[model samples]
Target: MRENREIAHTFDTLADLLEIEGANPFRVRAYRNAARVVDSISQNVAMMVREGRDLSQYPGIGKDLAGKIRTVSETGTLPLLEEVEKRVPRALSELTQIEGLGPRRVKALHESLQVNSLEDLEKAVDQGRVRELPGFGARTEELVRNGLKRLRGTQGRTLIADAEETAVHLERFLSGLQGVKQVTVAGSYRRRRETVGDLDVLVTCRPGVPVGKWFTSFESVETILSQGETRSSVRLRSGLQVDLRVVPEISYGAALHYFTGSKAHNIAIRKLGMARGLRINEYGVFSGDQRIAGRTEAEVFAAVDLPFIEPELREDRGEVDAARNGRLPELIRIEDIRGDLHAHTNATDGRSGLESMVDAARERGYEYLAITDHSQAVTVAKGLDVERLRKQLQAIDRLQEQYDDIRILKGSEVDILEDGRLDLPDEILRELDITVCSVHSRFNLPEAQQTERILRAMDNPHFRILGHPSGRLLNKRDPYPMDLERIITGAVERGRFLEVNAQPDRLDLTDTACQLAKEKGAKLAISTDAHSDSGLAGIRFGIGQARRGWLEKQDVINTRPLPELLKLLRNT
Candidate 1:
């Protein structure tokens, strides 16, 4: 069965390749739109195919696209993609992966420098050839070089979302096995880490059941590295490694606890057990040859006189003490969020238009949605100029009149220039309901300079949230040099806020940073920075980061109702 993400990726790559080939703009857009639809649909594409439903019924998907989707679902391959691959080298498609290199920039590079591969592009940059390009300057060249280095550093691991999708499919398949009783995906997947190295799946089955054999039957399994009666390991076509183990029902919970661990957390638990003359392992807990607790995670915790800890908090970060003292934070949940403050529209780089974005926010049950499109500094996004922003604000004012259920606020994700000035004028910024200032350029500034630059931006009374404060992309770029602690402290003193950007690629304000914000009594907003309505789903990743940071509902600014949230925003 084809995963939704895999099919979506195929479509996205096809669209990018077509764009590089200078295909029709409408044709390229059709594939891109279809990719978004496939990626964001609530249900699995495999399930839809299995049920024989019409995939063309979905937005942007036509009969031809539907047939291609069916082919991918049934055959695990798309013929069009195969045909396209023959003409376009895989390296050319990959060139577009670098940050700031859109299809147009990529096309420019290929045409000007004959750089079809990462190595070729890197050599060109080393020779000082990229900086001389028409659109790409010294800054863009440096950014691309850094992006390539980061990509190489984190090549094999998959995003947590991708791993979870695989786990969901595999778990469903195993649950359907005749003799299997329970299927639990342990390891980092269960803990909701931002990136997962591998998956460890624990299954409980009736005696004499051959569950391990059934596991290898998964269609996505690319190669069986090892197989045994009780255990098996395989690599999926997506390059994710998966291991399956069959545990006795009595030890299922213990196995889950043992495998779903940060080694440090597990060591702490083992030490705590040792102090009490209790032996703990993947088997049942033991006290002087007597089995005590192992059937449930709560039971395992209770055996050591500790409270059950959420998987997200299983990182030995004072969680042990918190659990022991019954002081574990009640982490924020997805339902606690009341609105999204930083979102975009087709007026900028966002794929969807204003009305469509608002409708998507409505679907999420948001009490408020802010149109925080990029400001004038970010030309690549066609960031809004003064006149365009005024028109957008007026349009937002009009849209607000039509919907009494949700408040639509006019906002801009304005840029924080290198000189510590905001991209949009304070006069225009104050007119909006809120202003989200971010650093779009000069990410390589020194620590002291960067800190001062942001502090000066925060000096503006209109500036509310600091968007993706560190400017780091997970597995793609290290955060720019800045004293984050001082910055967080400054935010508190100035009544400014930090954002936990929800985009998977940019889960900035890491878990530790979120906790720091909470400790300083500065609120944080978990925004999708969504470029499309479908991008709203990225909020889950943000919530995961928040929970891991031990954030509670009150710690997040958006958790409050509209009126209260508005008051908070105003005061801050």
Candidate 2:
């Protein structure tokens, strides 16, 4: 069965190819928009198709696009995509996957120098021919080369969001099996890493149950790599490999601990067990072949005289020592979030209207929701000008009167210009409840200049938080050159905050960066940067990232109640 992401990828590829072929602008945008709508939706599109439901009712998916979605879900390939691939080399679409190479640039390269693939692009770069093209300079060529390197480095890893979708589906399926008693997805996935290389599933079942065989026969299984009574591995249609293992009920805890690990953390735990004249392995902790403890993770930890550590903290980054001293952090949870600080509506590129967004926030039991639409710098998103933004503020006031349950704060995702000035003037910024200043373009500035640029932006009294601070799109664009330590320190000095953007593709302020911010006594706001109501749920991903970085509820500003949060914003 095709996943929503697979279907979305199909439409995106078709759109990219159409654009490279200079097809109608509307035609290309329709497919691109359809892809966004499909990917962002939480529903199982393939199931919807099987049930004969209408996909056309979804946003950006009209009757024609709905038919294409059904065809791809049923047959695993889009006919239109095949037709387009024949006319334009499919490799060109892949070229667009490289950063700094949009459809227009790819077309220009193809038409001028016949650069059809990565290999051709490499050759052109090597011969210094690419820089001689109309818009390609030495700097642009260097960026392309670096982007290619980054792309290859992250080639096979799946984003955590995509991996979670697959893992959840499988876990639900396996839990329903008659004899299965426990199922857990281990490894970096359990750790909530930003990217997952593969999945490790541990299960406990009855002796006669054929769990491995059932796993290999899952509907989404693309290839059965190996199959057996106790263990099996299969490749899903999304190209993610999964390994399932069956362990005894007595050793389920030990197996889960062993599989869900960083190698260093496991080694440290094993050494601790050894000090007590015991041997530790997946089976259990044994003292001369007689099992001591293993029935639960807590039992295993107690054997070593340490409290059970959270999976996100099992990275051996002082966690073992912290556990020994009882200093483990009380990590932040999704429920601790009082409200979302950054969100957009139809006023910008967001899908829902203001009233609908307010209703969604109220349904979630939030005290406040900031309407931070894009400013004028991002013209592609139809960013608002001064007059338009003032109009939005007036509208927020009117909408606020209708809802006492949720306070709708006025805000804007203002653009931080390349030269350290803001896109919108200070007078207008002061009238708003909040400002999430961000760097939307010129991501290639040198380290000193970029650092200075943001530092200067932080000097503004109205600049509340640094949005997507690193400006990286995972597995696609690299973070621009900047001194993160200095930036964090600057934020601390200026009483500003850093945004842990919860968007799946741009979970900026990485786990390590989050840790660094905490070390520097800087605060963070885990906002969804949501473009639609469904996008609001992305806060879970940010929470996972925060836990991995050892953040607690007190360390996050938005976790505070509305009055305290407003005071903090005002102080800034």
Candidate 2's C-alpha runs over 4 A off are: none
> On residues 416-492, what C-alpha lDDT tens digit does candidate 1 reach at each position?
99989999887898798888899989888899999999999999899999999999877766899999999999999
- The alpha-carbon lDDT assigned to residue 232 of candidate 2 equals 97
**Local distance difference test, candidate 2:** 0.92
Over 1-572, each residue of candidate 2 has an lDDT whose tens digit, in order, gives 67889999999989999999999999999999988888888788898999999998877788999999899889989888999988888888888978878999999998898988888988988898888988889988987888788878998799999999999989999999999999999999999999999999999998899999889989999899999999899999888999999999899888888999988898999999999998988898999989998878888888999999999999889999999999999999999999999999988899888888888888889999999999999999999999999999999999898988889989999999999999999889999999999999998889999999999999988999999999999999989999999999999999999999988888889999999999899999999998888888889999999999999999999999999999999998
TM-score of every candidate relative to the true structure: 0.90, 0.98
CA-lDDT, candidates in order: 0.88, 0.92
Q: Relative to the unseen true structure, what is the C-alpha lDDT of residue 20 in candidate 1, on a scale of 0 to 100?
A: 89
Look at candidate 2 and give me any clashing residue pairs: none
